[model samples]
Target: MPGLYHICYLSVAKLSALQPTPELGFEAIKEKTRKANSAAGLTGCIIFTGQHFLQVIEGIQEDVEDTFGRISRDTRHTDVRVLSEGPIEVRDFPEMAVNCGGDETLTAEALAEISAVLDYPQHQLHIREIRTLLSVLTQPSRKQDALLAG
Candidate 1:
């Protein structure tokens, strides 16, 4: 079988009744996204910082591309920009999809961390930075508080 690939992208949310109320809307989106991802045999994580979204998905190339295509056409998002994509020997996230909800302080910090790497030359991001980004996005909420504390 062909190896899986990971694709990361960032997007801004379009104005909508649900978009305006992030807490509720984010959960709704996450729930729907999780269900779809599960059915598609994809696994990864997504972070929503109220206005912006960042997601990393891992799966067969066709499935990943199809999922991304559907996401791009979804009415909820705008300004979709792909950050990175390439084949991987192993899945970084092999289980359930993770949804990192909006927490102002943590979100700001995480965005700053992600932006630094993204601002680098295209596809030139250091492996360490990529791992760090995954760590930041995948940290559980309980551990996230500890992350902020230390």
Candidate 2:
């Protein structure tokens, strides 16, 4: 069977959510990914900024496609935009990967904040607030390609 290469753009921001610093928060999230990937036998790379995240997950063609689609509404993500997708003959993340440390900062509080917004009264959801939230939860994932090259 041929492996597959995939990239996903996910936006998650935690302006003041994570305690301490981004490096610590990144560590926390990476740990979670590690466990999840192990359980599912999936491989991928994840990157984060204070305002967004880009990830590339690969595995069985069917499984990878299904998994990538599920991230659209993942609890960890708020506003998701699928910038691009394509098929490949090999796994991009042969064994799951992550790069978050050494001066790396984290941002994903916006995703949590948006989830909270859903609890508010419907009338309170302003257009501007939604737009801001989208921006906060939107991240470009082009670097995922570079991650492999790097």
Candidate 3:
């Protein structure tokens, strides 16, 4: 069996004008994504900062690559830049296809961090920055654990 892998990317959201409302647009995307990811046995989280999207996907190497390829070609996203990716000993989100509903403050902090590093040369992003983003973005997983624990 192939080892586990993950890919993290950031992109700007470009919603079509035809969508009746932003909530509807997001809900549609979330439903579609949930189905697709679940079918492919992939797991990850998607964070939307009102205008941009930060996502992390993990699974078998081929599945992760295939998912990222589709995401890169999707028209709703622009300026899709990968932050980090590599083999992982374990999955950060083992049971979730797409984690959502994060704390507002942490999401805002994550957006600020990503924006600050957006101008930096892609290769120049420090490991610390990547770690920080992962830590904050995965906060929802912790909440999920607590809810299940209770």
TM-score for model 2? 0.52
lDDT of each: 0.72, 0.52, 0.71
Model 3 has an lDDT value of 0.71
Q: Which stretches in model 3 have alpha-carbon errors above 4 Å? A: 102-150
- Best-matching candidate per lDDT: 1
Q: For candidate 3, write residues 62-135 as lDDT tens digits.
A: 99999999989988788998888999898877878877533443445545555555545664456446544555
Candidate 1 — worst ten consecutive residues by lDDT sum?
97-106
Q: Which pairs of residues collide in candidate 2? A: 11-137, 12-108, 13-108, 13-109, 13-110, 14-108, 14-109, 50-107
Extract clashing residue pairs from model 1.
none
- CA lDDT of 79 in candidate 3? 91
What's the TM-score of every candidate structure? 0.75, 0.52, 0.72
Model 3, position 102: C-alpha lDDT score? 33
The model with the greatest TM-score is 1
Per-residue lDDT of candidate 1, residues 1-150 (tens digit): 867987888777774836547667877888888888889889887777656677888899999999999989988888898878889888777877554545633656756655554445564555545545665557665546645654
Clashes of each: 0, 8, 0
